[model samples]
Target: MCSSFRSLLPALRAFTAKCPPPQICTSLRTYATEAVPDFEHKPSHYGQPLFQSHPHLLRPHELTPGIPSEEYERRRKDLMDSLPSNSVVVLIAAPVKYMSGSIYKYRQGSDFWYLTGFEEPDSAVVLEKNASSRGYRMTLFSNGKDSAKEKWDGPRTGFDDALNFFKADDALTIKAFPAQLRSMISLYSNVYIDLPQSPRKNARSTKSLLRYLSPPVNPRSEYETVVESLSSSRRKPLAPHIAQLRAFKSVCEQQVMRMAADISGRSHAKTMRFTRPGISESALAAHFEYLCSLSGSQRLAYVPVVASGPNALIIHYTSNNQVVQDGEMILMDAGCEYNGYASDITRTYPANGSFTPPQRELYSAVLSAQKALVGLCTEAEGLSLHDLHRKSCDFLRRELKQIGFTLHTGDLERVLYPHFLSHPIGIDLHESSYSDRGESLKAGMVITVEPGIYVPPTAQFPKHFHNFGIRIEDEVLVGEKHPVVLSVSAPKEIADIEGACQGLLGLEPI
Candidate 1:
């Protein structure tokens, strides 16, 4: 504690407890516990002292390339070969916006990252298939340094260094895109662009990438609004093509996925040890994400679903602000994103660190079904998501029936378990590739096997399981040999989870 704080009032103690630099403020929560059941804790790391001060990104860090130049060249060549003659493809990087505070946190678009591995915002990529001239197939329009703009935005990958830094055949200011686009459109017969979906999201996506190219390009305008202005005819959707390429994982892609899975798996295990009756749902999320940040994950794949008790029955319940009860179960579905690739995993455990008999039974059903699905992970089987989902339904149904609950209606299974057994996961949490449920399993793909059973307190049947819910998810990699579980460290086995739950929580190295 700082000496200046001791002289001040106690209410302001929280503001100064970690005033000094390098003081690791590790205490999870100090607020008096509220008596509410579902919505109790609400603590985020807003005022905690800095663990370690991170200075502005040095020139060395900024100049360093994200991936090898050869890789990007290979991808562009492959995509070009697949395209018809006299065709042009355009990729727009993600847009930027001001935060409530002055801080600006930006990320590159997944598709753009896939094609170019370029991280700068307000950028566009142009790929002209079957180039008529030598050394002129690819081009980039990026933000260059303006003394006034740099004062506010910090830095830019200006045109001079753009060719070497991003390995683009040519580089120009973002302002030149409209002319470049027009010239390419006049020469090419077919044009490709990422078609907009969801008006609100679409608006933000297009504006951030194209607003810099012209005057009066408001940030709120929709993607179609911009596309209509750029070309005479409708541009075909380019995302599906990129998705096709991303669907099959390369060796480097798998390596990053494996790394992400390890970080998430270890975090789940540590969070299980941290769970107790008095701990809140938000606390668990904080702890898990804290571990992820320490482990060097760039960002979370999605919101952490720290659902406890009957709340698990509601899928995608992101309001993780509840007090975990002694006899209740905790269902957490969380993952981390690394280098634009995603790793997703889910784990269910007892709130008190040891499951009751009913919980064990429910968990066993999901576990057994997931194991059976894992067995079906071979190229010869050619099993699809629909196939795995059906198998999961059957397993849950058999388990429920054995426990003496008669699902009198055909819709009962749908009511209890609403989601599919698995979905393809890669750059996106639910990867854009293979949109259909009937898409067949293929080698070099990674997916999540999550089968859950949730019974709400309001639902009929055994009163003991009224608020009970259980789900066990794992990351699976489909290879030539078989499906490999990437997150193998997190304990899903009954005995292993129980043994871990019985010990004192390890606060550090979690």
Candidate 2:
């Protein structure tokens, strides 16, 4: 054997020793004993697509589409560097969700994916700060290679490839993770973990690590269990630390987000042209999704709100079964997910090719308020989401009063504008949920500026504006001087929207 292969024999033997079953031990040993060149050239498969195999979807050295492996490494290093010495961070992957026997599409947990960039279910990673060195060590516990399982489901990264391809210092079968975590628990002074909560509704699958962690009685969480076992260590919530890191986007991340926005924006414009009187909302929603897929979106960001007429008055209305009427407005709040990033854009337009005077008046009011809120997204403005929301309420109140809808002192925020002005957007549609809305804006942050006015059919309101709802939303990236509107391709102006509906404004195919 070569010297390099000979040196790895000891660690390989140690890994094999941890295998729970004789068959698993044999499988792991076979990969470890193979020649390095043969292993490199073999037709091995991964849990997720890799650059070498899926070059059409990925560039060289990319772990995921549009994100290089080095960037994932830097994210891990940055997370560990922020923690105290002799710290250990544990992150668990999202479990595969099922509806009956069929499986829902798997999406990796955002925080876990942010750090490791390993896209597999039923896996966990531990980042141990080197007690005597400068850097940290990453250990991945993943599924062992099994021919029977591979034939049925798909290939796994397995132990040896986890070390070689994913840059993990050590790799072990997931069966050994509980024992390994217990052994390391006493050594670290600080433990940071983001544990999956105990399922309150449907129980998790037996293969899930979450099910393994969940106890039968009292239903204590994984976090609670880990905290109770620690005698001398300080336990910290891992989410806030990761959220702070995720709040600011890297240059490559910004590029991917811009691509996501463009895809969704163009899809929205196409949907606008397809809308017409007597069209069912559900059909319109399906057509929008079709356009997004044709333009390279992997999936819709969320269940789109394709509301028309009275349905538009209900915020978060997703029961898209109503047929649009000629003079009524259609409010379509939709976006797409591209390369793990999310884009959100909402536009309200007349079902017919032209808006009624009442509809145009309300649409203009919402659009003006939305523009003002987007302007405040810059770092120079130094405004928080709460501040911007207050500004939105003020802008809409004045605009509505000019349009003949007077509001009482607290009626504007309490009734008219029911939703917040902005939310951060990234890997998840609502990214960094733990982040503070009161915090000032930063240059690398991305948020949505959505403003709306929902009027009920009450005697206090003008009859022309009764039951009229109008909103305009766009994704904005905070900049040093001016905010960049990422979803600018989705037309929101009265003239442009009408032009798009009439198919005359040169709406380019995405």
lDDT tens string, model 1, 397-483? 887877756676754466678777888888889898546778888888788888887786654666767777677888888867677
lDDT of 2 by residue, 389-443 (tens): 8898889888988988767876777787888888999999999769899999999
Runs in model 1 with CA error above 4 Å? 1-67, 101-104, 131-136, 195-209, 212-231, 458-460, 504-509
Residue 466 lDDT, candidate 1, scale 0-100 = 78
How many steric overlaps does candidate 2 have?
Answer: 0
- Please list the residue runs of candidate 2 whose C-alpha ends up more than 4 Å from where it truly belongs after superposition: 1-44, 131-134, 201-233, 508-510
lDDT of each: 0.70, 0.80
TM-score of 1: 0.80
Model 2 earns a TM-score of: 0.86
Tell me the TM-score of each prediction against the true structure: 0.80, 0.86
